[model samples]
Target: MTVPTAVLLARDDVTIRRFAERDADVRRWTELDRGGAYLALEAPELLAADVRAFFGPLASA
Candidate 1:
């Protein structure tokens, strides 16, 4: 079960663990709003910042 467009990782284990705990809720929310999912749950700029924050190190390295 993977969201191809979603890169959800954190620099620390705790953050990853916490986010992992909410995986089910996110999935349910996505399912509940199929139309929103199709259109993207967040705006492009917000999503770019989030992905950059999560994968900054990888990108720089």
Candidate 2:
């Protein structure tokens, strides 16, 4: 599969991480994933804010 398709369709964290490890260009997604996970554990309110910022517009749809 193509990199864009793989990145867009990936839902499993392990799969995403593997892709990131194999592809330097897609590494930011992995970084974001890790940052999000860390925020979830260490600062849930911040995570909530990020979720809102990232998904709030979609909520209207």
Candidate 3:
């Protein structure tokens, strides 16, 4: 599915971030080598950074 479809699936009250893997197939979705499907498990630091980035603005507001 496209990014738009994924965003639409989220709750209206939620904010979504779209990130496409640099080496992923053009027709499929793939995660980074260091953090694939299990983002938090494979790369907790990166995942936490992303989560913070996504919500940081809201927290300041």
Candidate 4:
């Protein structure tokens, strides 16, 4: 089957990492598949918020 249609709606790496480091499947997390869950939550506004959340801090950094 083809890859599922999903987007971060968000793509903040640190956030994604934090999430994965949390209750996520630590050992096999995204090994066989990429961050499909992140991909699955796609929405235009959320993606924008994610971008802003990341870049806002990055802009200062």
Give the number of the best model, judged by TM-score.
Answer: 3
**Residue 59 deviation, candidate 4, in Å?**
0.4
Model 2 TM-score? 0.35
Cα RMSD of all models vs. native, in order, equals 10.8, 8.2, 11.9, 12.5
Each candidate structure's count of clashing pairs: 0, 0, 0, 2
**Candidate 4 off by > 4 Å:** 1-42
For model 2, give the 10-residue run with minimal summed lDDT: 3-12
- TM-score per prediction, in order, is 0.32, 0.35, 0.43, 0.33
Error of 1 at 16 (Å): 12
How far residue 57's Cα lies from its native spot in candidate 1, in Å, is 2.4
Error of 4 at 26 (Å): 15
Give the RMSD in angstroms, all C-alphas superposed, for model 2.
8.2
**Deviating ranges (above 4 Å) for candidate 1:** 1-42
lDDT digits (tens) for residues 1-61 of candidate 2: 2233112222223454664546553412322333333456655665566556555655575
Total residue pair clashes for candidate 1 = 0
Q: lDDT: which candidate is best?
A: 2
Positional deviation of 51 in candidate 3, in angstroms?
Answer: 0.6
**Candidates arranged by lDDT, highest first:** 2, 3, 4, 1
Query: Which residue pairs show backbone clashes in model 1?
Result: none
Please give the lDDT score for candidate 4: 0.40
The local distance difference test score of each candidate is 0.39, 0.43, 0.40, 0.40
Write one digit per residue (lDDT tens) for candidate 3, span 1-61: 3231111111122222334323232232223335455655766776666556555655676
**Model 3 ranges off by over 4 Å:** 1-33
